[model samples]
Target: MSKPVVLTIAGSDSGGGAGIQADLKTFNSTGSFGTSVITCLTAQNPDGVTGILEVDAGFLEKQMRAVFSYFPVKAVKTGMLFSESLIRTVSRILKEYRAKGQDFHLVVDPVMVATSGAKLLQDEAISSLIQELLPMAGIVTPNLDEAKILGSGEIQTSQEMKPEAISLSKKLGVPVLLKGGHLKHSAEALDILSFPNGESLSYSKPFVQDFNPHGTGCTYSSAIASYLGQGESISSAVGKARDFLHSAIVQSFPAGKSKTLNHNPD
Candidate 1:
């Protein structure tokens, strides 16, 4: 039961599908201890999100301080920080830790939209994430739509992914995982990993037909964070994480009416 402690600073999903739920489940599957600091709470099901309640920024930092006081987190990830204020607060805490020489990595999932097409991150949150969060992120995982918002506009095909991945990585000075799950009519789901050092890699898995899953982005980024937390290199972490996520998605099943990834025992 001895595993490296990893932290997820994200929103609570009442649906138990994405955000903190998906992240903690991935940590457990990938052999890491998971701790969480909830930034907000969402009333959502597999079908959609109905409501949201954000935590106070001061209390959010309090949760972070409490976690840091006990466990030396090796890697951390952020999901669904719905406000610029929330984004700034989290970055400030991480900056403080880095100043004191606490070694850790950050995985930022720019969660802009839900599986059901609802806007999760407010419009004002984008600049905050770019200015305050992305610079500190060890890697940022953005789906096709998010990639468009981040820099490359309207990336509708697999061809546009690599350049955007590289460009965004160079622009942010951090590794970027540009996920190609939403590209229509693609035979295989392609994901491009662009490193800040001008290197890149691509991983592809056969698209799971009929499995339009929820929590996939959350689960994938969490797996990478978990592997990195366990001292795996970025390349190894993402490669292994990609494999793990493929299997999880392949094993997906229905939760009531909506499809969801079966990350348990992954």
Candidate 2:
């Protein structure tokens, strides 16, 4: 069977739990062929990130060219682009592809902080991400802190997420999936998907406790991209992805003192 090709532009996680590793796993699980463009490399484990090495912008561009030129990339998801130069390079090259009428769905996971509290995206790159990269996205998935940084007021509850998601969607001129996983006080994990046109949908599941996996964000966004690659609508993609992630978390097992998602849970 010929599967749809989904591309992930993200960092490499040596732990094999997040970033490019997670994205590829999710893509494969959700029935897509996965391709990658490495933006950075991280020496990290579930406990914390030890160090990072940013890929040169030229090499990043070359990777993008190699993938896009050869594969019929139906969708792309981006994670941890560490610098302003990298963000700009990605924006420029993707824009060039779009200019040539090569349409593909883009899922932007606005990854700022890693699960272990390491800063993935640099502060200076944030403005570039907002101005250049986000506008090209089909959807932007941001956790609570990321939403707050993306110009939302304090979001401490699921109810508070609605208005913030709406506002951010309008501000970014794209669909926003404001993730409520950080609201540890809540019994249910809630995520609000709001569109620029004022419509919204809620995706809620019982919060999985003691299951902090390293790659959940990377896996979730890539699952959405995989579904989009399979021609699902945005709302359907988000819903299905949310369910996919929930299942992965529920079936997770330990990996060297920290838990990692069971990407192939059957």
- Which of the numbered candidates is closest to the native, going by highest TM-score? 2
Q: What's the lDDT for all of these models?
A: 0.90, 0.93
For model 2, residues 1-266, the per-residue Cα lDDT tens digits are 99999999999999999999999999999999999999988999888999999999999999999998998889999999999999999999999998988889999999999988999989998999999999999999999889888988998777888998999899889999999988967999999999999899999999887776688899999999999999999999999999999999999988777677999987
In candidate 1 the C-alpha lDDT for residue 23 amounts to 94
**TM per prediction:** 0.97, 0.98
Clashes of 2: 0
Candidate 1 displacement at residue 102 in angstroms: 1.2
Question: Cα lDDT for residue 16, model 2?
Answer: 93
Which pairs of residues collide in candidate 1? none
